[model samples]
Target: MLGFLTARQAGVDDPLRLRRVESTRRVLSLKLNPDRDVDRIHGNGINTIDIEAVEGRYMLSGGADGVIVIYDLENFGGKQQYTCKAVSTVGSRHVHKFSVETVQWYPYDTGMFISSSFDKTMKVWDTETLKVMKVPDRLLPSALSLPLSFSLFSASCVLTFPCHKVPYGHRAEVLSVRWSPRYEHILASASADSQVKVWDVRRASCSLLTLDQHNGDKSKASSEAVNTAHNGRVNGLCFSGDGLYLLTTGTDDRMRLWNSATGENTLVNYGKVCNESRKRLQFTVSRGCSPEFVFVPCGSSVAVYALHTGQLVTMLRGHYNNVDCCEFHPDYQELYSGGKDCNILAWVPVLRASDVEEESDRCGRTALVNPAFQDAWSSDED
Candidate 1:
């Protein structure tokens, strides 16, 4: 750390390089923080959670009990232990009839947010009033598999409605949708029919590309296996920071990387990711890291994997039940995860030994650290 600082001070190293290295180290050292906690508000499992990108000081969460909560993540008070308070909530009366599938704050500000639910309704809400600002046409539940809906905030007709009946789109329910960070018009959708398609919103006549797991290798694919992203349902889809590469997870217990522009499967085998969710799975990729990391919910734990190499970095085992969603706060290099256990766990970067005082203070801090953060690997094999 001192060497990098000295090199940076001497103008011998790039400033961004030092930041990326430190960010990567922090991500690797992420552990369940005993001090930072999110106040429990949901009676049922948390389905989705998102931190606003503008300030990164507020978080939005939706739960299976049809509740939506907005948390103030900024810790203004000087304190070691802090619980993120729910500043606003939408509960009971006007709440969705079923599980709230997703909640997201408006891209530019915190004054507006949007939420969608299994009740076949999507609503736009005013942050201050906590009341519906706009309620679009309620969707008719599709007979195919799940009654999936995408919360697309836009002016286009296709964006307003779930485009299932399109001549060149997924025949089954579209389980997941994500817009590319690099391209405003580029979109990716995963469906129950075991296909992943990339679309250009302006040209809705057909998808720009349909990802193939086989990568156009006909001899290696069976008839049914040809041009499919996964053998089972593809529930998760995430793009790399640059939007040059894409990562996908499916019920087939596998995760694959793909070249976004060419639709070529990079085939970096992230072996047996253990995804059993019948709905959309929310996973995230790390930002400001040299070789990025992927944080995904695998059963009760959040699995960390190397983005390019497909190497398992660590397993964050803090949740008691199946973890449904996780959101990364890039500004602080912290992670927030929610699960069926009705808990939201904050995984924070551990303070380096040098950051502490001499011997006594280090010993005291070590003793107070949560056992859940300790590595349980056995040395017996060695």
Candidate 2:
């Protein structure tokens, strides 16, 4: 009876209820560094963050108050409780006129970065000089419209450097953008007006493909008013490792997958998720697997879902407040989530055998086989 109860508690199916199950487990309170925390820079809440994986060892953050700050993530002074020191700033005097929405590293180089602002511009900046590198006009052609009851909004374009020359395209405020892993020059972007555009970055005019809701092959003009892909504002977008598919989240509290090459909607439903009506959220995909997985920031928790079938696999919960972004580190099989609580939490899967033994030991079951496994289980059971 105790064995049966333990298996059921671990989400065993009816047929396999009695058999010991090896499932992905979660440990909520494992602390990486209780002493060190992300230093706050924004007087208002932070809106976006981008980590540079190369030599500078820096992460860039944009805020609701129109400030951009670069923080050094590495320990320079060899202190136990090292605060993330600000390396440079866009200048408080000449800060963005509107809230900065996104900050991203250049696809090929580490010395350059890009940021998009509600001020209707995407500025490319040289990391060393900390100044605008390229000031190309990439705004959407749509007129600004704000519903009186809700908040004032405008359609904006997202920027990506897939190759040296080919520019990506979007007809609305590009809420999110990502590059394809298989093809270096291929990139994708989602917009508030419910369109996803793909670009080769080498072309002079017209996108390679315009993912419209209507059925047709011809690319529509930027001014054409068409039915949106989602009922609400599209807020988040990501591409799978293979780059064969794309995932999008919206203010309507849903997530959908798409066939990248064909522009066919997979229509997988993640019911009643967070309402990202205003800000952009980040999601990631795990690579080198048969059935790839996607990690989505849904309100206060990160929801892991099967990519192909679009089934909710598990919900990793730890954040005390709404989670704004999540990234999956495939090299370690770990996930990092950051949010309104002003903290980033690292989540790792608990070993299946360990969880089963722990539960069995908690129920006061005796192990007749190996005493070492029993001792190991007893330590964590408490």
Candidate 3:
């Protein structure tokens, strides 16, 4: 980090390069922070959490208890020991009849947000009033609304296409859905049927691409495995920051990377991700890092993996039970994970004093090297 700063000061490197380098270092050094806590309001397991993108100062969490809570993440008191306080909650009245599967803040505005649940219903909320603004159409009778199922959100109406009615809809339940970060109309959906499909919302008659794990290699595919993205249920789906690559995890205990544009499997082997979740798994990717990282919920730990190479970076091991969701705060380079332990743990970047000390020690050692043993060619020539 010092070297990067020196280069930036000398105008020898781009300012953006220094930022990326520091961000990557911070992400790599993430550890469970003792000073930070999120108020535990959920009586049951947390299934989903989303940090608002507008200000990155507020967070939303939905739990299996059919409750939704909004937390103020900004530390206004200027203290290291800080707890994110629950500013508002939708607790008793008008709560979902079953587990709340997903909650997301409105991208352009913090005044509203949306949530869906297993109760076959979706609700849009007015953040200030903490009241249900509208209950959108009930989910399809056969469709249990899992996390990441909703397609679109607007200020007035929450729209979800009955993709089940499409020409090539999944026969089984859809487990996850993600919109491309690069393209507004392009969407991806994964299903319990082991298939991943990309759709253009404008042309909803049929999917645009059906990802094949085999990448059309006839010799590697059997009749049943021809077009499937995984051998078992594909429950997790996350797109890289640039939306060029897609990462998926399945009940088969494996994660695979895919080329989003062509629907071809990149075949970077991320070994045994150990995903057994029957519901949608929420994972996230780092935004400003060069070789970006993916934070995934693996049983009781959140597994960090390199985005392109699929190498397991590290495992965050604080949750006592199975972790259901993990979210990354890009601005702060911090991570928040929720689990069946009924706790929300914060992973923060450790201090850099040790790095400075190491650098100084190396310099001191070089200076103390024996003068007689040192090469004197340069001194002699001078």
Which prediction has more favorable lDDT, 1 or 2? 1
Query: What's the TM-score of every candidate structure?
Result: 0.85, 0.64, 0.85
Full-model lDDT for every candidate: 0.79, 0.60, 0.79
Clashing pairs for model 3 are none
The deviation in Å at residue 172 for candidate 3 is 0.5
Q: After superposition, how far is residue 197 of candidate 2 from its true place, in Å?
A: 3.0
lDDT of 2 by residue, 281-343 (tens): 777776543345678887788887757666565677877777776655444445656667755
**Count: clashes, candidate 3:** 0
Q: Give the Cα RMSD of candidate 2.
A: 11.3
TM-score of 1: 0.85
TM-score of 3: 0.85
- Candidate 2, clashing residue pairs? 155-173, 156-172, 156-173, 156-174, 166-201, 166-202, 167-201
lDDT of 1 by residue, 132-188 (tens): 885434532211112122532221233222445655657677777887888776778
How much is the lDDT of residue 269 in candidate 1?
78
For model 3, how big is the CA root-mean-square deviation? 8.1
| Candidate 2 TM-score over all chains jointly | 0.64
Query: Candidate 1: which stretches are off by over 4 Å?
Result: 135-166, 354-382
